[model samples]
Target: MAGAINATDASKRYAVVTGGNKGIGFEICRQLACDGVTVILTARNEHKGTEAVEKLRGLGLSDHVLFHRVDVTDASTLSSLVHFVNTNFGRLDILVNNAGVIGLVANESALKTPEERLLNMMGAISHNYELSAECIEINYYGSKRMTEAFLPLLQQSKSPRIVYVTSGWSKLENIPNEWAKGVLNNVESPPEKLDEVVNKFLEDLKNGSSKEKEWPSRMSAYVVSKAAMNAHARITAHKYPSLQVNCVDPGYVKTDINFNTGKITANEGAQNIVRVALQPEDGPSGLFFDCNKIVAF
Candidate 1:
C-alpha cells in the first residue's frame, strides 16, 4: 500500500503544473500552493514564466511557488524539469497536464465580443494542416512525454497522482470517426494503439479526407489530441493501479486558448481540475471527471 496518505499535508507535497504562466494553468498553480504544496509553475517562455512567479510572490505564495521553463513538446526541457524535481524535491506528488492549444486560428480583432463568441464557439475559428500537427504534437505527445519522463520521480512518492486536463471535445461522440472512437473505447488498448488512432486522424487531415473519413469536422486536431490523452490516462491507470490517474474537463473557461472567449472564469475551471488532482491515495483511477462527476469517455 502507499504510505499512510493524507491530502492535507500540503507542506510535504510537491506538484508541477505545465503551461502555468497564465489562464487555468496559473489558477491551478495558485490553488495548489494555497493548499501549502510547493509548486513548480512552468511555461514555454522564460520571461513570462518568471513574471508569473513574481506575481505569486506578490500574493505571498513566494514560499510555495517557483518557476521553470518547460515546453512540453521539447524533450530536453522536460528532462531539465525532471532533473530539478529529482534533485530538489526528490519525488513528485501531483502533476497537472494543463497545457493545450485551440488548434485553430482566429482574428481576435475581427472576433465578436466574448458573449457572442461564447454563443458561436465552433464558428469563431479556422483550421489548417500545420496547426493541426502542432496541436497533436503538443497536446497528446507532449503529455505522454511528461508522464514517461516523470514516472521514476513519481514512483518515489508514497502517493502519486496525475490529472490530465482534457476537454469536453474529448467525448467520444464529439469525434465522428467511429473507428478512432473504438480505439479510445478499448480500455485494453496500449499506448501504441492510441498513437495509431491519432496518426490516422493526421493522415486523413492531410489528404483532405478527414471529413469523408468521418473525423471531427470542426476543431479536428484539438478534439483528436484530447481524446488520445484521455485514452492514455486510462491506460496509465490500468498499468499502475497504485497511483491515482484521471482525466478531467475543466469547463469552458475564459483563457487565451479560446482567445479569452470562454464563459467561465479561470478559477472556476481550475477548481475542478485541482479537486481531481488532489484525490487521496485510494481514490478512483482511470476515470473521466466532468464537473467533478465521473462521466463516460
Candidate 2:
C-alpha cells in the first residue's frame, strides 16, 4: 500500500473538492495542499472561490492550490470543470463531493422525532435553516452530475478515489420501508427511478402531504438526498471496479451548513474524508462510513 505522501511528493498528485470555499471542504483542500497535492478548490461563486484560494495562499500554500468556479447543478459548468482538469492535469487522483444541503425541518417536531433518536434534536433544529434557491438541484443531482462528468478523468489515473460526503441524517432505517425497498433492492433498476423517487418526495413536501403516515418519518429532503448519493456511490463502484468509491458522514462539524453549532471542528471532520481520499489501491470500495468505521448500507 502507498503510504500517505508528503508535501514534496504531492505535486505529482491532483485533487478536486467541490464546495471547497468554506467549511469542511475548505479544510480538506488545505490538508491536501499541505501534503503537496495540487488541489482545486471549487465553488459556485467565483469570488468566494478566489478568496478561499487567497486564504490558503496567505498560509504559503498558494503554489499548491487553484480555484475554479463550479456549481454542480450546472451541466455546462461541470463540463467546463472536466475540460479544465483534462487540459491542465491530464488525470485526477481524488474527487471529493463535499457540497450538500439540509432542506427539512430539523426541529423537535412531534411528528418527526423518534422515541430515542440519538442525534441532538435541538441541534438539528438549530441547523435546519431554510433551503436555498438551488439547494435540491445542487445537493443531490449536482453531486451525481459531478461524478458523471469526472468519471472519465478519474479513469485515466493509475489510482483514483471518489469520496461522497454524506450524513448520519441519511440513515436508511429512517426511510419508509416501501421507498427504501424500491431503491435498495437491485442495482439494475433504472437510474431514472431514483430521480422519480426524489421528485415524488419534493412533490409531497410541496403539497403538504408528506405528513401522511405512509411517508418516511425522518424524510428530510437532505437526508434522502444523501442516502441516494450513498446508493449511487455503491452503484458506481459496482459499475467501475477500477475506481475506489465510498461515502462518509463527517460527524457534525461546525460549518456554515449548521450555522456553526456543531460539536466537531472542521479539521477533525475533514480527517476521515482525507483518509478515505488518500487510501491505497487495495482499500475498501462501495462502502458507507460514519466517522471512521464502515456502516451498514
Candidate 3:
C-alpha cells in the first residue's frame, strides 16, 4: 500500500475509480489528478493498475495518483478497498463506478466501422444467458456493492459524490419490458425493487423467455444493467441527500469494450464523467446526463 495521506494533504480531494487501468477509466484518473484530486486508480489486475498509476506519475502527477487492485464483483476486494480508503484518506470525496462489460458478443470482422456496428448491432452481436448474468453482476450489482461499502466514508466527507458510468441506451423508453420499466422509473420504489427487476430478468433469461417477455432481444443485458444502474443512482441520491450522485452516458467513446469503433476519444468520454464527479456541493443529484447535458432518465 502507498503511504497514508499526510496532514499536508488533508485538505485535498480523494477519489477511487474502478476499472482505471485503461480507456475512459484511465483518462478519468488522469483528468482528476490533473485537477489536483488525489486518485486511487483500481483494477482487477494489479500489474495493469500499477502500470496505469506509473503512467500518470510519469506525467508529473506522482503525488496525485496511486494504485490498488479492486474487483468489483468480489466482496473481499470491495471491503479491503473501503478499509484502505478510510485508513489512508479518512474520507472519500468521490467514487466513480466506471467498470462495465457489454453483454453481447460481436463479430468484429463483419463490421468495418463504428457507424456500421451501431446500425447493425443486432445482426452482428449475439447474447447468451451466461453473458447476460455476468453483465448484470459486474455492471449493476458491482456498482451497488461499491456504493454500499463506501457510503459510510462518503457520508463523512463535506462534498461526497458518486458517478455511475451508464449508457444512453439505458433510458426508460428503450426498456421494452413494462414491468421492469415501471419498477425502475418509479423513484418512490425502494432499492429492493431493483433486485426484483434484476432477478426477474435473469429468471426469464434462464428460462429462454426473454424475447417473449419483451426484454431487449439484442444487447439485452447491457441495456438492462445500465437501466438498473441509473435507477439505483436515483434511489441512492434520494436516500442520501447529502451526496451528489448522478449517472452519465459518456457518448460512445473509442474504447476496447467497443472494439475501438466509437466516434469520440477516451479522453472525451472521461471528461464527461469527471465533470459530474467534480461538481460543486450545490450541484444537482439523481439526474442523468447525456455527455455534458442533463437528460431525462
Best candidate (score: TM-score): 3
As a TM-score, model 3 comes out at 0.94
Write the number of the candidate with greater TM-score, choosing between 1 and 3: 3
* Per-model TM-score on C-alpha atoms: 0.92, 0.85, 0.94
Q: Write the per-residue lDDT of candidate 3 for residues 112-150, one digit (tens) a residue.
A: 776676556545334677888999999999999999999
Please list all clashing residue pairs in model 2, or write none if there are none.
Answer: 7-35, 10-36
Better of 1 and 2 by TM-score: 1
Rank all candidate structures by their TM-score, best first, as comma-separated numbers.
3, 1, 2
**lDDT by residue for model 1 (1-297), tens:** 011222334249999999999999999999999998888999999988888888988999977888889999999999998988887778899999998886776545655676555435465333588988999999999999999998888888898999999998889998877789888888789789999998998888888788778888777798899999999888899998888999999888888777686779999999999998887767899999997889999
- The 10-residue segment of model 3 with minimum total lDDT is 1-10
Model 1 TM-score is 0.92
Q: What's the candidate order when arranged by decreasing lDDT?
A: 3, 1, 2
lDDT winner between 1 and 3, please give it: 3
Q: RMSD in angstroms, candidate 2?
A: 6.1
